[model samples]
Each structure stands twice: as C-alpha cells, then as structure tokens.
Target: MADIKLSGIRKSYGSSEVLHGIDIDVKDGEFVVFVGPSGCGKSTLLRLIAGLETISDGELQIAGQKVNDLTPSQRKIAMVFQSYALYPHMTVYQNMAFGLTLGKKGPLGGLLGGGENKKMIEEKVHKAAASLKLEPLLKRYPRELSGGQRQRVAIGRAIVRDPNVFLFDEPLSNLDAALRVNTRLEIARLHQELEATIIYVTHDQVEAMTLADKIVVLNDGYVAQCGTPLELYHQPANKFVAGFIGSPSMNFLEATVTDIGPEDIEVVLSSGKVKVRLPVLPGDLALDARVSIGIRPEHLQEGSGEVFRMSSRVKVVEQLGEASYLYLENGEDDPFCNEPFCVKTNGHSSIRTGDSVDICAALSAVHVFNASGIALTRTTTDSRYIAPRRA
Candidate 1:
C-alpha cells in the first residue's frame, strides 16, 4: 500500500491547456474514483499519474517520493486500459510473461529460450491465472476467450506484476451490462485481497458511487467536488455538483423571494399559487433576489402525507414498475425546460398524466440556490423576503 499525491498539477497541449492545477491525494490502499463527463480531463489526469503524459507543471509524489521524471515503466504503477490491449496472436501465458521475460533480472529473465527460466515464467503465469480463475485457459488465444475472460486475463496480466498502484481507465466500459456488474464485483474483491491503492476513472456515476471510497467529480478540467458518494448526493457543493451526482437528477424551479426576514424566506413559484417557505438565515440572502429552488423528485410526495404541499398540472408520466416520475408543467423560468419536474411517486403509483394534483414537499428536503445557481446554506425558516425581484 502506497499513498499518491498530486500538488497543483497542470497539463497543456500547445497553448490550449487541458488540466488546470489539479491537486488530489490518495491514501494508502484507498480506492479513489475520478468521474466526469467526456473530455473532462479524468483520463488525462490518470495518464499523468501513470507517467504516460507530461505534467505541464506541479509535483506528483508516490509513497513520499517525487516521481514526475520517472517513466511509466519505472513508476511501479500498472494501468488496465479500456481496450484491454492484449497480443492477438500470443497465448495468455506468453502475453503475461512478455514483460517479465524482457527483464534481465527477474525470475523470467531470458527464460523463453531455456528450461529453468521457462519453468519460472510458467509457474508465475499459473499463479496469476489461478488468482483470476484463468488457469484453465492459459493456452487459449485472446480471440478464444469471451469478453469477461479476456478482461480477467488483462487484469491477471497486471496482477502478476505486483505493482504498487493499479490504475483502471474505464476497464468495464467494453463489457455487457451483466458482465460489467460481475466484473465490478470482482474488482471490489481484488482490492480487498490486494489492499493496494487503486485509482479508477469512469463517467458512469453508478460505478463511481458503488466502488469508490471517495469520488472526485471533475468538470471542464477542474475538481467540482470531492467526497463520499452519499456526501455528494446529499450535500452538494454547488448546483453543478448537485445536478451531476444523482440518477434522475434534482429538480430546479425558478423562484423569487416573496419575503425575507431573520431566518426564513418566503418564495413563490409560477407553476402554483402556493407560497413555499425556504429555511435559511437572511443574513447573507439578498432580498427580492432571483433564486432557484431545487428538490429531488423523490423528496416530493404525492398525497397529504407530506409536510408541505403545492399544486401543479401533471404534463407527462413515466412508469418504471417500482416507481414513477410525474413530469409537471410547472416552472417559472426554464429550470428544467419542460424537462418537467420529475416527481418519483410510489411503486405502481395510482397517479396519471394530466392529473391536476397537489404535490407535497418536506421543507427540510428543499435546496435553495441564488440566481447564479450556487447552493445556499439552508437553515430553519425565520422571515426576511418581503418582496419579489423587480423586472
């Protein structure tokens, strides 16, 4: 187990910079995940850590040693790429032994042409194969193995090296849905057994949420937020973090401060005649401020069973067996665009589309943000907002 640190790391191509001073720390044996949309520099950061890309500036330390000048092969790091780059013509055994065979000091040094060297290489291969449950298919070619088998072989190849850090670059992207789940479980087991620091990169939120001890959410080459999956899910740092971390995503509604007093602010939405109360101290709040109110669909309840209620016209309804989302024709400014406020109703819900209904929301479940789309520190309602924003 080793700790990896990046301080003020930056990357650039010509005059256009891709990464802008990213600083992250991975504790010994911690499984960290980098998640973001495509072209968000998640892969670039991984490459930089693997020494595959040059750091434009800043320091990279592994196990308290500066390794910026070290090459990929010398970094004591192993990377499993998305493609599973295996030798098509070679058997699994030969492929796994290739790196060790090229060495002049390892147990497999110059072994392909001799007896003892060959035996050592074969033994190591068998051991790795056994670990990955690939011993039965050692002689099989890459093409002969199924997708999952091939992926295991790729991981086996890395496991044999016994490197300090294992970097996975979207390793499960190529597998089928079911196979991906199976492989994901396998990775979790492998980490428990090896207890090595593993940095995984993937755009799939599910993967990041499920596998990481901490998730680093990146956006436009910057760290948007870093925390446990539930932290990012429950307490997002900003609007972007809130919107990006969830599955159905939080619903945002345009609103104005109707009354701002000492602790709570009153807000009114265009979709309903009801006045919604926001629990936040008015010290930092701007009166008559243009603001946005965000709430998870799951937070909005369908009957009189909730703490607060607001009425709206249901525009569309999507049923998913376990739950349903009611898209309401409710918005002041295009908070969701007719993206409609998705309300997750109960399983086999009795609600229907176009049903004019009263939706209830727990006051504590609301997330209020300023017009700039920055999340506000919500407190219990006091009273401050007394007027709406002037046009």
Candidate 2:
C-alpha cells in the first residue's frame, strides 16, 4: 500500500493554465475519485501524477518518495486507460507477460538465464488472473473477451506489474450501463482484497457517489468541493455545488424581501404578487432587498407544511413513476426567466392543468442566499430541513 501526496501541483500549456496549484493527500489504501465536467483537468491531473505529462510546477510523491524528476517507467506506477489499451494480436498470457519480459531483458534476460525465473513470472501471472477472475481465458486473445472481461485483463496486467499505486482514467466508460454496475461492484471487492491505494477519474456523479471513499469535485480547473457524498448534498458551500450534486437539482427563485423579523424573513417572488416567509432573519437586509431562495425538489409538498407556502401556474408536469416533478411559471416577460420552479410532489398527487394552487415548503427545508449567492447559516425556520438518514 502507498499514500500519494500532491502539493501545489500545477500544469500549463503555453498561456493557458489547466490545473491550478492543488494540494491533496490520498491516505494509504484509500480510494479517492477525481470528478468533474469534461475539460476540467481531471485527466490532466492523472497524467501528471503518472508522469505521462510533465508538471509545469509543483511536487508529486508516491510512498514518501518525490518522483517529479522521474520518467513514467521510473516512477513504478501502473495505469489503466479507458480503451483498455491491450494489444489485439497478442494472447492474454503474452500481453500480461510483456512488461515483465521487457524489464528482464534490460538485465538478466530471464529465458537466456534459466527456466526457474520464467516459471516465477508465470506464477505471478496466474495469481493476478485469479484475483480479477480472468483465469478462464488466459490462453484466449483480446477479441475473445467481452468489454468487462477485457477490462479485467487490463486490470490484471496492472496487478502483474505489482506497482505501489494504481491509476485509472475512466476505466469503465466503455461498458454499457448494466455491465458498468457489475464491474463497479467487482472493483469495489478488488480494492478490499488488494488493499491498494487507487486514484480514479470519472465525470459520472453517481459513480463518484458510490465508489469513492472520498470525492473531489472539480470545476473550471479548480476544486469546487471535497467531501463525502452526503456532505456535498446536505451542506453545499455555494450555489454551483448545491445545484450540481442532486438528482432533480435544487430550485432557484429571485424575490424581493417584503417582511423582516428577528427569527424569520419574508420575501415576495421577483415575479411579483406572490410572497413566502423563509427560515432566516431579515436582519441587515434592506426592506426591499432582492435575494435568491434555494430549495431542493424533495423539500416541497403540494400540501401545507410548518412554514412557507407559494402559488404559481403549473407549466409542466412530469410523472417519474417513483416520484413526481411539477414545474410552475410565475407571471413575467421571459417564460424561462419566469421559468417554472420545480417541486417534488407525491408519486400519485393526481393534480394537473392550469392549477393555480398553493404549495407548502417546510421552513427548515428552505435555503436562503444573498445577492452574491452565499448561503446563510441554519436558522430557526431552517431547523426543519432534516435529511433522510440512510439505514
């Protein structure tokens, strides 16, 4: 097992800087995932750590050794790519043995020396195949294996190298959805068995949520939020993270403050005529101060709750079979600008059409933000926004 450390690591291409100075410490035998939208420097950061891309600045250490000046081969790191990168013509055994054979040639040249060394290499190959469940097709070629099996072979090849650290760049991206789930479970099991430190990169949030022990959320070449899945969901630092991490996404509304109190603040929708009291004090906010309110779809209900309530024109209704989402449009110039605010209603609410109806939002479930979108702390009204605990 190894602990990987990156301090002030940076990379640049001419005038465009891709990775800002990033400091991350990956604990020994931990699975850390780097996740973000495409072109966000996740892959670049992986390449820099693997020595495939030279760092424009900063340091990378593997198992307490500084490897910045080392070549990819000298770094003793094994990487698995999205394409699997297997040689099509070589048999499985030959492919697995290729790297070891090449290393032997640089020194003792195993076969030219003795049969015992070759036997030792074969034993290690067999052991790795067993670990990945690839022993059945050791003699078969790459064309004989399924996408998942080919990936297993790729992982097997990495295992045979026996490096201190394992790096994966979206290794399961090529598989279909169902296969992806099965392989993910297999990988989870493999990690426990090997107890190896792994660094993985993926754009799929669900994959990051499920597989990573710790998730690093990146955006625009910088770290947005880093935490366990629940932390990012329940307590987002900014609006961008609040909107991005959830499934149906959070709801945003522009409104004018109409009432202020020591314990609660009331605001009217910027769309006009509609007002709702939220779970925050109106202190320091001007009487007519314009602030935005954020609430998750799950926090809304068609029926009344302990706190705030609203009314709007139903623009679009979607029944997800498991749950329901109703979009409401308030009176405004641009339809989307006065776009339908979303609410998570019952799977069988049975409410439909031009329903100028009232909706209730529990005071605790509401998140109040200032003009600049900074989230305020928990208030008496917000005390009710309790997260559903996982059993």
Candidate 3:
C-alpha cells in the first residue's frame, strides 16, 4: 500500500486548462474515489497519477517519495481501464503472465527467454487466478469468456503485479446491471483482503458513495468538495456539492432573506406563499438579499414543520417499489427547473398528478446558499439539532 500526495497540480492543452491546482492527500491503504460529470478531469487526474500522462506542473509524491519523473512501471501502479483491453489471440493465462515477461532491457529479457525464472511467474499467476476465481477460465481466450469473466481476468492481471497503488478507471461501466453489482462487490472484497491503496474514478455517484473511504466531487476541473459519504450528504460545502452528491438531487428555490436572527434566518420563496426559518447565522447577508434554499427530496416530509411550509400542485408521480417521487409545479426563477420540483414520498402515497399537497422540512434538514452559491455555515441554539463535530 502507498500514500499519494498531489500539490498544486495543473494540466493544460495549448491555452485551455483542464485541471487547476489540484491538491489532495490519500492515506495508505485508503480507498479514495474521484467522481464528477463528463469532462470534469477525473480520468485525466487518474492518468496523471498512473504516469500515463505528464504533469505540466506540481509535484506528485507516492509513499513519501517524489515520483514526478517516474515511468508507469517504475511507479509500481496498475490501472484497470474501462475497456477490458485483453488480447484477442492470447489465452487468459498468457495475458495474465504478459506483464511479468516484460523486462527493463527488452521483450527478449522475458522469463521464457531471459532473466526472470518460470516458477516465479507461475506462482504469481496461479495465486491471482485463484483470488479472482479465474482458475477454471485460464485456458480460455478473451473472446470465449463472458463480459464479467473477461473483467475478472483483467483484474487478475493487475493483481499478479503486486502493485503498491491500484488505479481503477470506471472498470465496471461495461458490464450489465446485474454483473455490475456483482463485480462491485468483488472489488470491495479484494480491497479488504489485499489492504491495497486504490484511487478509483467514475461518473457514477452511487459507486463513489458505496466504495470510497473518502469521496472527491469535481466540477468544471476544480474539486468542489472532498469528505466522507455522510459529510457530503448532510453538510455540503456549496450548492454544487449539495446538488451533485444526492441521487434525485436537492431542490433549489429562489428566496429572499426577510429577517436575520442570532441562530436563525427567515426567507420567503419568490413565487410561492412559503416562508422558512433556517438554523444558520446571517453573517454578512443583508436583509432582502437573494438566496437559495436547498432541501433534498427525501427531507421534504408530507406534514408541515414549525419553521417551514410549502404547498404545490403535483405534476407527476413516479412510484418505485420502495418510494414515490413527486414532481410539483414551481416558479420560473427556481434553480432546478421552471415547472416542476421533485419530492420523495412514501411508496404507498395516495397523492396523484394534479393533486395539491403540502410539504415541509425541519430546520435542521434545510440548507441555505448565498448569492455566490456558497452554503452558509449552519448554527443552532438548540443543542439537540446540532451535529457533533468530527474528531
């Protein structure tokens, strides 16, 4: 296992820059995930760490040693790409053993013809095959295996290298729904058994939430937020982090600060007869300042709370087996959309489209964002509602 550190990292192509001064410290044996939308530089950053791309600026340190000039092999990092990238003509065993055959001198320096002994390669290959349950398929070609089986072979190939750092670039994206779930579990198990330090990149927030010891959310080439799954969920740094981390996403409504208090601030929605008193300090926000109120779909309950109340007409209702999502009509100035606001309700909810219903959220569940989209630090005089600080 290895610890990875990046300081003032930047990447550019011609005059356009994709990454802007990225700094992160990944602890040894930790699972860190980089998640964002397309073109957010997640994959580019992963490649930089793998030594597949050159870092235009900044120092990269692995296991406390500066490795800015090291090649991919010298970095001792193994990357599992999205595509299996398996050789069509070679069997699984040959493909798994291929890495061991490559020597610093040349292809001729392989175990079959050069320095490394045959027994060492066989031991590593058989161990990896057993670990990935690929022992039976070792004799089969890539084309003859199922997608999941081929994926296992790809992972097995990486496992045989005994890398200090493992890099996964959306390795499960190519699998079907069921296979993806099963493969995800397998990867999690492998991490626990090997205690390997892994840096995984993906656009799937669910994958990030499920697998990461720490999750980094990137937006427009900058890291918006990085924290544990629950920290990002319950206490986002800004509106972008709040909206991006949640599944259905948080609902943002245009509001105006009507009154400010020591431990609470009152705001009214622009196009609705709704007023909310949130548990956050006003700070530099003046009266009548435009702000946005963020509340997750699941946080908005059916009954009204003491601090907030909202009523809207339901436009659509999607009933999943576990819960129902209600799309309600809202104003044009709303952040998410013009017509409908999403709200999560009980699976057995009787509410239907065109029905008028009231929804509310507790003061503790509400998030307030200032004009620049930065979330206000929440504070409450009520000790019961205040969350304990992380040690």
Per-model TM-score on C-alpha atoms? 0.89, 0.85, 0.94
Per-residue lDDT of model 2, residues 1-391, tens digit only: 7888999998999999999988888999888999888999999999999999999998999889999999976788889999999999998988897777656444355545433367778999999998888888999999999999999999899888888888999999999999999989988887888888888999887888788887788777788877767767776666767777776888887777888887778887765655667767554787888787788888888866545776677777899987888888755542224435788888897878677657777667777777776666646423345433445
lDDT of 1 by residue, 223-309 (tens): 988887877777677888888887788887777788887778888764445577777665576767877777888878887676667
Cα deviation at 32, candidate 2, in Å, is 1.3
| Candidate 3, number of clashes | 0
lDDT (0 to 1) per candidate: 0.83, 0.80, 0.87
Segments of candidate 3 deviating more than 4 angstroms: 103-112, 331-339, 380-391
**What C-alpha lDDT, on a 0 to 100 scale, does residue 282 get in candidate 3?**
82
Pick by lDDT: which candidate is best? Answer: 3
**Model 2 worst lDDT window (10 residues):** 381-390
For every candidate in turn, the CA RMSD to the true structure comes to 6.1, 3.7, 2.4
- Find the number of clashing residue pairs for candidate 1: 15
The global Cα lDDT (0 to 1) of model 3 is: 0.87
Sort the candidates on lDDT, descending order: 3, 1, 2
